[model samples]
Target: MKVVKRLIGQRCLGIEINARGELMGLQVLVDKKDNVVLGEELTGMNEIQAFLDEHPLTPIALSVSSDEIIYSRTDQQLDDQSMSDLLRQEVPSFDPEDFLICYLDGFYGFARKEAISEHTSALSAYADQVVLLGFGPIPAYNLALTLREETSDRLTVGSYQFDLNDTDVQEITPQDLEVGGLTVAAHQVPAFLVAIGYFQGGLGMMGYPFAKNDENLWYGMLLNKLWKPVLFSILALLMVNSALFLHFNSLNQELNEQSVLMQNLSDRRATLASYIEQNRQIARLGERESAFAIISDQIGATVPAAVTMEQLVLSPQSADRRAESAYQKEKVLLQGITTDLKAFSLWVNRLEGMPWVSRVASQKLTETNGVTRFELALIRHVEES
Candidate 1:
């Protein structure tokens, strides 16, 4: 056996090991100030025994693999009976009132029965944490009953039971409680602690699924393990979604309001347009009234005593009419005495020369009952000046 030593003060200690059982490393626990506290090593029982022997007075502690410590001598046999026999040989002797012992295993063989019976006398002296590995139907059932009596208040067994027959090594089952309030088979108490970051190595090496059987309980534990961060994430997502929904809803409402406003504006614009058109028509009617008045005054002033106005007509220019003729001519018919063609011509010329009249022409001249009548045309100007 090779021995390595490092002096360190009080602190939590850790050890690492490789697959091959060899002492490969050693270190002293150091703080930020480079002060040493605990010592660590990757070594076996020989080194541990030596260290303990040398530091008999000092409070020395050794961290061991849960599996390795419990099943150290039985690795080659692999059978429950053989492993039980090995445990009987290797397990430390117990002293009642000073120690307490509890076994966790899937089954018990002959050796387990002997070990349990022998250790029962000093079970109280054993540490709170003790476990056995392997599975058997008779052993499990028997152990369940025994644990009920032994660990009634301070300890429990198989409260959470893993199926010893399960090869997948993933299945776990919670133990059903009997008349007592104690949970003897619930593996969750230990496994849950591990998942929640309470326990790290040794007996806490198992993951959630391997330690719990109830799917809901398993999931609950997992969620609880990650509860803080998961809860925060869910809350953040809900807040973001709510904000987005509110924003879109507000935008929709605003759009609807704008649409209504635009519709009202459009209706008002249409009404205003109609009013403007009506006003335009009214202005045009007023201008036409003023033009008619001027034409009436000019016609009355231009007509001679020999000519009598029979009918006068005014109308808008026609599309088919010559542009100049349309703007400059108004049809007029006269029925009165005119001495001769010369007199008719003179009256026509005078009417044409009037400020508000033009384009005078005589289309007919007839003598009847010793009176001369003529039909003429004249143009009315829009503005008097």
Candidate 2:
């Protein structure tokens, strides 16, 4: 007999239920020959909510047992109707509505409706996608079918046997045994069966796999497997968009407020610029009026009675609009005749005591006729900028 090679890239999550009904998962890898069970792993069943949170994408295959599975056999060849009637007779407590009956060449299988619903629900909680749903010890029998071809003589797993000569499958007391240099441990049979069952179910050979669903394959798979991922993806995308919209709106409001403030400050600065020159001219006039008053009082207080002024000249330069100057200082020139030089000298010394006089000098001194003639020039103190 020619052996078909296993699809090398094929892999699945093989799962079985414990006595507590908790799931035990194994990662199975397929090679050219038998399917390999790599190791046991922490199942996503208890952590179903977390799986939905983080990894809503991994596929799952489950070998579940929630129903009362009854085995029956018919000696006469049976049609679909007869097989259904025969299965009911074999398990009297079974109802057609609550249970689905499966027949494979006169071998009958029965499982309750509620059991399948519960099993698939539990599987979806762990994975959004259920790649395959298989029931009872069927995957084990699926393995047995493959092993029979490999051994060629007789192959056994626990109490189940895969015989080359016999068409019918049978069960005996399970034990650990070595066949063709391979040791089949009793405890390892369940996991091994699940992996082989998943492997064969994926292969789609002759369709009499351990579990068979003749009618509702498409509806059952779509409702359980693909719905959740599509729904969750949409919701997460909407939340991100909403947050971004709010952040942009806040920045726009702040930008508008700053623009208004900047425009107001620019208008105020333009209005103040027109009055700049007017303010400077008025301020300069006030300072010159105060200085002239101080000078007049000092000259009258220090002048000598013997001196008679022939001429007096005070020249004060005004702020020139063309030069754009803020203010200009004043200078003094006096011409007088004195009967005595002693009086003239005394008068000059007293003028030096005034705050505004920086320097006093006699520009001319001469004896003409009966009186002495003199010319005096004065420099006024100017404030630094």
Candidate 3:
């Protein structure tokens, strides 16, 4: 409640009409703690209005002289709505609506609405709202509560003195007013304390009933206090959401870029694999060609001049009737005509001496015409030979 009062920035402009018919005004701005922001003995309507203009947009608490108000005490418990009904039941001669009613303690004070409007309408132009619109010493009741350290049930200021109660106040004569307890001369009672009471009363610290329309002002002040922080919180949430969205969007874009890079790397790896396979095939073909060249050179160097070579085949297909042509082995087949069989026999023995030739077999030997025709098969060792 104290925080709410501070947030609404509730201030009070307490004006009292003195015995001399001069307008005495005091302005007080309330916070978590009580502070008399401005205190001046304002006289005349122009001075009051100017004083009020100095602190614009503050609630006003006007206190008229006791003579202007009709005071009554109610024995029964009453509410704001029933105050007028109670006044009408008590004073049936006049209309209850014609007066602005204020109930404090057990007493109800009724001031003519026209009389209050005449003085307040002009002053109201300078104030934001009206907190209290009736009674002279009403504000002093709250002032006594505020000054708890000062044990005074009565307050005297200016020419008039008022007896203060827990929820009531009564104007008394100078002789009837008590000794120096909480007395302030020079119209100081209503000047400072009344302004402070306006704040307290409006804040619901004291149960003094104000004008009914001031309820709207109270609600408006509450709304004014609440909406600023709510709006700021909404804006803060929006900023956080926007920041998160931007952060996630940045990460998403980076992920997409990484995916594309990964795909490009994958394609490059596949191309490298294909190149390695082609290089392996080329290496195998080169090895086979080198092996064939070495075997042909060894065969040419071991040949005999007495034997005429007609045909020579390495790793020949088998010619056996039982075996298919698909079967082949590491063997050399030679068909030739030799004029001297003795030279052939000597050449065969030399061929068997070679490391590559395991054995040489003579398959056929026949005298055809004047040349001796022979067919030989040379078997090679298991490996490349």
RMSD of each: 18.4, 15.3, 9.2
User: Better model by lDDT, 1 or 2?
Assistant: 2
Per-residue CA lDDT of candidate 1, range 1-385, in tens?
0011122222221222212322222322334343433244424545644553443322211111122222211114234344434444655662222212222333222223333323322222212211221222222233333455454423223233423233112213535434234332232222212111111122212211122222232243345556788899999999999999999999999999999999999999999999998998698668667666766677767676666777654544556676534633344333455766676688677777776555554467778887776666555544422
| lDDT scores in order | 0.40, 0.58, 0.62
Which digits, one per residue and each the tens of the lDDT, describe model 2 over residues 139-172? 5555555566566656666556645454556666
Cα deviation of 196, candidate 2, in Å? 2.5
Candidate 1: what lDDT?
Answer: 0.40
* Order of candidate numbers by TM-score, starting with the best: 3, 2, 1
Q: 44-159, model 3: which lDDT tens digit per residue?
A: 78887776566544567766665666665555545665676676677767565566676654555676766655655556564446666546555554444345356665655334
Q: Model 2 misses residue 185 by how many Å? A: 6.3
For residue 77, model 3's alpha carbon misses the true position, in angstroms, by: 5.5
Give TM-scores for every candidate, taking all chains together and pairing residue i with residue i: 0.38, 0.39, 0.55
- The global Cα lDDT (0 to 1) of model 3 is 0.62
